[model samples]
Target: MDNSLAELDARVSGCRACPRLVDWREEVARTKRAAFADWTYWGRPVPGFGPPDASLLVIGLAPAAHGGNRTGRMFTGDRSGDVLYAALHEVGLASQPTSLSVDDGLTLYGVRVTSPVHCAPPDNKPTPWERDTCRPWLVTELKLLRPTLRAVVVLGAFGWQAALPAFAEAGWTVPRPRPAFSHGARIALESPTNNPLELFGCFHVSQRNTFTRRLTPEMLRNVLRTAAEAAGLPTRPYAG
Candidate 1:
């Protein structure tokens, strides 16, 4: 992580603003999944990971209860992560296709992954109020990344919805009428002093979607490659 990102990560990790989230995340950690009974869970908020100077940002929904909550990293230790990281690897954004743990030696070249709600919510859904409360962190993080942040690939409608407001809060000129989210949704937000920020939408990489083929690796990788290219990154993504 970059120095500024490290500072933000530290603060995000220690956040306990939402009492309900705090209680629930800790309770899940305490219970421990049967398969991960011997593993120590990262019950606290999972901070966003990636370099601060990244040009592309990947915003997800919250961490998975057993996946990220267990592995202490976004999209790690879960079926969803398996699909996501594989697509990222194929697109040349990630160093490896597997992100099973925080120390897994996986590095993102020009992308950062984060979320609207940092904590793992019950039923994988965070209440609207909770979403609003956590908006400041996203807004601040965006402020820091404004220099190089060029594109944002939102994993789902939830991420799309959450990000629009943060961009507006960070003083970007948002479109008057918000664009609706779709599998291949795309929009551009203009900034007064910085380059325009492109936003792309894709279905969430959840088991519900992947298992049913609602979201395939091809679909996700296409969007990722497009976003990476739009950000001026190399486009020679591997087929692996």
Candidate 2:
């Protein structure tokens, strides 16, 4: 199999390993949300979005049922994306503050956004078995990105837990017992052939977190900037 990102992404989009997830995503696409009734939903699995040579990677749990699953792009057409892209734009990592669709022309400077699970799961959650089953795709992505990848920002504990093992499989030396996930948590992972990878933890940009103020814009930007710097990528001055 080719190790190219494009090749891996094509394979990701075609995956039908999880029967439940495949059925759920397709069913959601067929039923269509009332708000998006006129739009064609991207019922297939979602792939990572960004340049192939990105230095920093943002890992989330999974695509939202009507968000990425509808727009065919990670984090597109959703409130969570609104919060995330805004912060990324403020910090100069993203070209725009909004990501409404795949053709919106939004771009990431030196950061890539992906999730452990590609398919949208029911209630925005995937079962443990589904997560494990989907792990190989993420591991392959990590391996392809390893050449220039230097830092990772994992959103939420689910992503954090899912990413560590992938990082290890992709060649980073994860510490024993694995580092626990918490907002603002940082850990250094060693690699035999590459520079050490800096890992940072942040709360998921879900509405539940942002609306409740558990994860503020400032907090999100702070983590992003720190990880960007660690990745050796320049960022714009903080707006606030």
Model 2, span 1-240: residue lDDT tens: 456989988999999999999999999999999999999999999999999999999999999999999999999999999999999999999999999999989989989999999999999889999999999989988888888999999999999999999988888899998889999999999989766899999999999999999999999999999999999999999856
TM-score of 1: 0.96
| Prediction-by-prediction clash tally | 0, 0
Q: How many Å off is the CA of 196 in candidate 2?
A: 1.3
Q: Where in model 2 is the C-alpha error above 4 Å?
A: none
Tens-digit lDDT track of model 1 for 1-240: 234878888898999999999999999999988999999999989988888899999999999999888888988999988998888888888899999999989999988999999999999989999999999889988888988999989988888899899999887888878888999988888987867898899999998999999998899999999999889888654546
Candidate 2 contains a number of clashing pairs equal to: 0
TM-scores for every candidate against the unseen true structure: 0.96, 0.98
What are the Cα lDDT values of the candidates? Answer: 0.90, 0.94
Count of backbone collisions within predicted model 1: 0
Clashes by residue pair, model 1: none
TM-score of 2: 0.98
Best by lDDT: 2
